[model samples]
Target: MGLENVWVATLTDGLIRADYIAGIETHQTPALTGKPSRWLLDVTLTVSAGSGTKDSWEVSHLHRTLAQTDVYPAQAAEELARRLHRLRRDGAAGVLRTYVRYEELSFEFSYFDAGEAAE
Candidate 1:
């Protein structure tokens, strides 16, 4: 079986934008153990500031073999939205960095700010 999901968000007149996707592939063999009937989760996140502009900067995360079950993709997407909301509420000042760590997997990303030197 194969499954894929995606999400996108735009806020503040396109100043902040994000894209997220999660997928699952079943019936795969493990490279290390050579075990069959293994499942794989692929997750990706792309966030941008000043989207479509010259000064825009983006951050992205990609993870393979994220989970044995397919449920994590949806949960992870929700978590990401929650975190982004919290950051906006707390005045993120442009999402300089972001990260997520759950169970045995972790994702980290950094955004490049063209305006950083001015501050």
Candidate 2:
């Protein structure tokens, strides 16, 4: 599937959520400063097939200002894709919540499958 479609499916299938996906707003807190610290990526996604039930999804710890040496949106996207791939391997239906954290220059992700509780 195309990148847009993949994102849509990932959200619709509960691999991710619409709310966790940031918008055009930028945040500049004390912890987050400097260039490349505040950025938002607008993506257009379409869900080709629906699961016929509401699927709960969440993504936290997407990015951190302390560790970023450059534009980190692309790296975050890649980490999300990697987590989604791992979630798909389970072959179960329901919500999949993914949490991503930075370990040095790499990203570590943990997933939670809520199963029928997602409904």
Candidate 3:
């Protein structure tokens, strides 16, 4: 399946909870104060989808500030990795009850129409 949606969740007690939608924006500035200007990455994770059941992990999404300091990049990467680990862990846990949380973020919508034909 294509990227219909994206979500990011934090895990606690073997359950992943929806955090917030991840928004990514980039800004650039010229030199200032005799120092070279640079680009800035602004990331805002908002809560889009409401709280879901333990099995609902598709409600969350993730993003990060790619142009920020090394720490931010590291943290972002680590957080994403950790979430994936949680997803896999659920299957391994082999628990009767499973819950996956998700954060809602803006997404690109795409679909195929019956009338539209490919070249």
TM-score of each: 0.27, 0.30, 0.26
lDDT of 2 by residue, 1-119 (tens): 21221222231233444323432222332334543343332222322323333575443334222122223344555554554454455433333332324422333333234333331
Model 2 stretches with alpha carbons more than 4 Å out: 1-37, 47-71, 92-119
Quote the lDDT for 59 in model 3: 55
**Residue runs of model 3 more than 4 Å from their true location after superposition:** 1-18, 47-66, 69-119
Candidate 3 local lDDT, residue 54: 89
* RMSD (CA, Å), each prediction: 14.1, 12.8, 17.2
- TM-score rank order: 2, 1, 3
Query: What TM-score, to 2 decimals, does candidate 1 have?
Result: 0.27
Rate residue 102 of model 2 by lDDT: 45
lDDT of 1 at 25: 29
TM-score-best of 1 and 3: 1
Q: For residues 12-61, write the lDDT of model 1, one tens digit per residue.
A: 12222332333322234444655434333333434222334567765445
